[model samples]
Target chain A: MTSQLEALRRELDRINEEILKWLNRRAEVVQEIGRLKLKQGINRFDPVREREMLDHLVRINTGPFDDQTIRALFKQIFAASLKLQQKQHEDALLV
Target chain B: MTSQLEALRRELDRINEEILKWLNRRAEVVQEIGRLKLKQGINRFDPVREREMLDHLVRINTGPFDDQTIRALFKQIFAASLKLQQKQHEDALLV
Candidate 1:
């Protein structure tokens, strides 16, 4: 059981690194979008797009997780990306 | 520019799926850990361990995101996993 636990923890550590990599990748895309939107004078927040993304995720979800929990987690991720983009935008303006 | 935006959005979609997979993987590990802790009469929360994880992440973090933001993101991930484990524990109790 201890060995099993150790293996699981090792897997968790690997997953954490994968998550960090994906998050940074996502952030890079989000920042690019932010820049494009600014250039086009488009709105920063798009509720319709966000909703569509969530709905797509729900349709694709084959869970050990329910749809609601999936939505919640994705929303948190979305919010983080949004926050990162916003911060970048602010910094750009300040410069 | 529009093509670039579309490409970026596609990349974001791919990253989103990767994040979902990792999050689920992390959740499974957390659940197993929760079970082990319960069986061993160990405490559910471990502040020192959590701090060590965060500190390790900080030491390894590479740019575009500061230590604070990385810590915030990891903490959010940790909280979600904890909530998942608690719910599983509750359900196990009811059974």
Candidate 2:
């Protein structure tokens, strides 16, 4: 039998891969949003929508991780996506 | 034709679901690690390993998100996981 730590590590590796895939998918959506926002002359950041999302996540969290940490993680995700969107917009401007 | 924003929002919704799934999976693994650590009398927090992970992430990141933000996000993840492990250990001790 595999050691418990080894098994757990394997699971973590699998989940990390899945997270990477989802992050990339999210980035693609952010790029699309950036394009649309540029066309509409809209700001990329939407604090109200982000707050709504965090609230939703808080409601649904049945966690080993607490609310504050969950919020922090989601905020990082949002910040990363926003940065990705901004980069896409800048690249489009240059092209 | 679907408005670009609406289509992008749909994609974001799909990706968010995937990300949520992966996060939960990661949490499960973290709990397992907690159990193993408790049994082995090992500390849950491993700063060196975490640093190695952040370094790997930095090397692999091709991002609009800078290295500092990536490291920060990973630190949050590590902290959350460490907390989860501690909680598990406490619960098991009480059982």
Best by lDDT: 1
- Considering every candidate listed, which one attains the maximal TM-score? 1
lDDT of 1 at B7: 85
Tens-digit lDDT track of model 1 for B12-76: 77777888777777888898899988888777887887887788777877745667877888888
lDDT of 2 by residue, A5-95 (tens): 7777777766765666567667767877877788888877889878977887777776656678778888889988887777787888899
Q: List the residue pairs that clash in candidate 2.
A: none
TM-score of chain B of each: 0.91, 0.90
Regions more than 4 Å wrong, model 1: none
Which ranges of candidate 2 are over 4 A from the true structure? A90-95, B55-68, B93-95
Highest-scoring model, DockQ: 1
> How far off is residue B76 in model 2, in Å?
1.6
Q: Per-model TM-score of chain A alone?
A: 0.90, 0.89
Native interface contacts retained, candidate 1:
0.46
